[model samples]
Target: MASQSLAKIIANQQLNSKDYRLLISAPQIAKEAQVGQFLHLQCKEGIDPLLRRPFSIHDYDRQQGEVAILYRVLGKGTKQLLERRPGQEIDVLGPLGNGFDLTNTADKVVLVAGGIGVAPLVPLAKELIELDKEVAFLLGAANELELLCMGELEQLPLQLKVATIDGSLGHQGYVTELLEELLADSYGQVFACGPEAMLAAVQEITLKAGVEAQLSLEKRMGCGTGACLSCVCKVKVQQGSGFEYQRVCSEGPVFRADEVIFDE
Candidate 1:
């Protein structure tokens, strides 16, 4: 049901020296996007970069026909994207991939984010709040300067906590340290988007806590679609100890924590 389109840029803001946010007009994508879905944004015109970069759905307004992506400038592709200005059009394909399932989830939810991975969890928090659930957000980064979306995140009604490796702000540690405290207080469900090491830590911790956790994984992608195996991750077999590869782009950017088999 999804198709490629040239989305008109409504606004583009440099959140920091490294991060950027773009609000584009894509009615179909905005209407269909869910909490953890993503957009495949073309970096620049033609095939200069050769492939579209994947950005998680940061925010959207169906009524306004708007969608936003929060991204970090990591390389050639995103570097070119920074040159784009408002009123320009960008090629995009989206509302792609499965998102978190909120079915019969706990009333107390915790969201864990590491660095730029926090993008998708912002929308999930909004959805959880709208469902009348209590949400506690834990964000971790290298330092306060690296934190993205803190202003928007703080505006939400849910509880917010922060951690940094350098102690530049908030708690002087990883967000997982924060996650443990909230979970100990009877918080039941967890949704996390972060780096592999942090996600592995989360998986280990939540497993011991005996609470359910879902992880939104990040992998390099050549195609945001499953046609290429560029973004595959190993997931444990439902009936056995063996694991199978699944595409992060199509099958998930989200998966149950226990179902994943982390690399040693």
Candidate 2:
């Protein structure tokens, strides 16, 4: 079951002016957390920022009872997180949201990410590697500055492809272009977590390629729990021709590509 705790911040370091990595000692969450799950963090002491900010579970070590949260400071909630120092306690409720399914027959897998959304994929890639699966990681960001977790990702035993809009890195365009080339090689599955437009494009590409894919969605949530019904997304019903709203917090954050109904 999901529970709340005051996770002790072991280190909260700024990777750059915009990105941060917070390592916390939360045994409860660390052992239970799976790839693509998230943490609902109380960004500040007071209620000025009411809703707890949800960040993808970036990385974790069950032995050490630690979890990492890599986040970009896009708004007030995230901006406030920067002030937190080591030795402080952060209120956290997590290992929430459904995680990506790893039980597949596919041995060759492609991992796609956009900006900070790459957080969950790092762990997913590592886990896939341990299972003796061939993994390829494709990452996209506006520029070199937005690319998160490059150091950790580079250390993994997998193929890495990067793309930045300004041509600061690998390819001079979207990372999907890399996926297109890889599709020819007969990969087993694709897993992606990123911007909506990018996910939609990935869904189309993989569907046309006849490859299986799982997508981790991002949404602004009112309550990290299932209550309040704030973070609902349209999903194609299993038995219907139309769509039905699914709770992104409870039903997913990760859902099969065909199940999601992306806005056109």
| TM-score against native, each model | 0.97, 0.97
- lDDT for residue 178 in candidate 2, whole number 0-100: 89
Tens digit per residue, CA lDDT, model 1, 19-96: 998899999888888989888888897754365899999999999999999999999888988989999999998888
- Global lDDT of model 1: 0.91
Whole-model lDDT values for every prediction? 0.91, 0.90
Q: How does model 2 fare in lDDT? A: 0.90
Model 1 lDDT at residue 245? 99
What lDDT tens digits, residue by residue, belong to model 2 across residues 47-113? 5438489999988899999999998888888888988888988899898999999886498999999
RMSD (Cα, Å) of candidate 2?
Answer: 1.2
